[model samples]
Target chain A: MTDPDTDRHNAKMAKKKAARDKIMATKTDEKGLVIVHTGKGKGKSSSAFGMIFRCIAHDMPCAVVQFIKGGMGTGERDLIIKNFSDLCDFHTMGEGFTWETQDKSRDIEMAQAAWAKAKELIADPVNRMVLLDEINIAIRYDYVDVAEVVTFLRDHKPPMTHVVLTGRNAREELIELADLVTEMELVKHPFRSGVKAQAGVEF
Target chain B: MTDPDTDRHNAKMAKKKAARDKIMATKTDEKGLVIVHTGKGKGKSSSAFGMIFRCIAHDMPCAVVQFIKGGMGTGERDLIIKNFSDLCDFHTMGEGFTWETQDKSRDIEMAQAAWAKAKELIADPVNRMVLLDEINIAIRYDYVDVAEVVTFLRDHKPPMTHVVLTGRNAREELIELADLVTEMELVKHPFRSGVKAQAGVEF
Candidate 1:
């Protein structure tokens, strides 16, 4: 006993629902933006690694460009050198650490190479996530162009791709543009005790 | 200026130094092993990701097999989903954690598939590093064979390829043989305040 107008309206609603479902089915999302982990604290890169695990939980690919520490002697690095290449693209800068490298020019050169590789990843549409590990410290050291980095990320971000920047001394402009930013303050560290970093712990 | 016998001794010493230098130059150890990050702490895989950055500094490779988290709408996962298929080989158990999985049998099935991949890497002689990620927690859940894992690691560990296993409740036997062990105790957690995990911090 419904009126013709009511029946037609119900029919229109059904069509609209169908159209929404169709859009949902066919939609392809470009990835998200960037996450920056910084501050003079502990566990910045550690936080980024947690994201890697989360991404992998769903079988997403991830890439890492480590800028600060390039040592091959650490146990953790040893493990990655042996295994994660297949899971993710991993590139290390040549310098171990600024304090450890002892030569400032040498450290900057290594950082530049790492940045070159990292730049390629950030530009690629296929790379969903890129972690610029410890590049903040390099920026602080005047090793690379902070302005260039900020501009590149804003201009060249891929659809659906996300990047994470980690290190001490994240610049203010970079933090402002980041989708998320964290600062870790170190209350204590075993290093102050003159204890050498154990293989698996610090590295 | 020395006698003929003394000159010969000096020549031998110089030759020994040269040979040592040559060996160092020719060594294939540009990379090291991959870590299997596990544990119940707030940031086990986070630590691993930090190391991934370290590996990239050396232009090395790394693999991460994420277990016990997946199929949910997570900001981190969505951000990196684009990268999982190629540059990084990531497999999420899709079962979430033990409490969340609710079905014990399902967890075991998923964990077995994960271990299959881990076993392959563990047995491979050429993989620079292999990160099992959470096999230790799986073992605690009765998802994997502790004995089999121990045997495989002991007998099949490739020369120069190192493995890092992280997780809470790591069996004493596994600890005994580890070249390095780091115990991360939870001092405080957001969950205590009834805060759900943030996308970047806990993902």
Candidate 2:
């Protein structure tokens, strides 16, 4: 009772399913990965935070250390602090952005302290994921040495810890070392049209 | 006890703060945003979910209509169903990918149905945010008319309901209509190196 179109469609789908199965069979290697989110567009930090929420849903321990945002009251940060303090070790270690701080020596000191906490979190086997939010900006400003950060990640990170480093202008060394890297290219932004950042979205 | 560096830093920060305050004074307009996330990389859907999590934190009602993933048991979907069900209305409308479905008529029917649900959510003032997940793919394939979608979005959507569309190869017309658009460019992918997607990250 099947029509000719239905038969053709079924045949095509079966072939595709078979091909996908073949590809899936070949992908068996399993290990923790270094993921990098960068570029001029948005979602670099938001996506990392999404992964953190996923970890929370799965009951996996995770840590987040903000490098440049300081202690500013972001919706994501506040939510985590209020509901997920037990599951997440969240830290805001900077006074503010570089332009606001306007002190190179102090910026470098703050970056070093944040990096120390990040390193400790990466070494902990109990933590399933670690997000070094905005570390790329610190690296770009030369406040934190990218080579040292890369070396520590390579040598000290636990086998099962997925480390996510996010910010614009990620260093080539870190990108080369990462297993996954996505550059969020800016296509269009409303701020150019005089729209300010708003709550529940921008925060 | 104040050193020259501290005094210099203080003066510079004060000037920067004043400049920021001036800029902040001008940004007062508030409205819903048309957000598009597209290109050949990850985090498009993840970041949208992050926004949804932010909405949940704010006790803002949201809706998600997944167009291409079908009824896959993703961790994000499960978490929303289990814990955030009261806050988020989630729907998976597609049978699968086009290749997996291999039925043009059926795909078109499913896309239309999903669009109807999306429109309902967008028009409702109660929904602060509505995610048309993977709608770009449906538009790219012509399964759903892009012009009608854009027209309805412009004319019928509530003023305060932020509409987020996610998928690869977003239509230029949609981009032109969007207030925010991000192109996620793939820098590197673990799947290329034979690493499979893992739980609590890929899901």
Tell me the whole-model lDDT of each prediction, alpha carbons only: 0.60, 0.86
Give the TM-scores of the predictions, in the order they appear.
0.47, 0.91
How many clashes does each candidate structure show, in the order listed? 46, 0
Candidate 2 Cα lDDT to native: 0.86
Q: iRMS of candidate 2, one decimal?
A: 2.5
Two-chain DockQ for model 2 = 0.55
Off by over 4 Å in 1: A1-31, A70-74, B1-45, B48-202
Residue A55, model 1: lDDT of 55
Off by over 4 Å in 2: A1-11, A70-73, B1-24, B70-73
lDDT, residue A129, model 2: 93
lDDT per residue (tens digit) for residues B18-102 in model 2: 8987887777878899999999998898888878878888899999999977422266777788778898999999888887877
* A42-154 per-residue lDDT for model 2 (tens digits): 88988888888888878889999999774223667887888788999999887788767777678889999999999988998999999999999999978899999989889
TM-score of candidate 2 relative to the true fold: 0.91
lDDT of 1 by residue, A48-164 (tens): 765665554545677888886653224434444465555567777766655554455566688888888988987876666788888888888778889988988898878567788
DockQ scores for all predicted structures: 0.07, 0.55
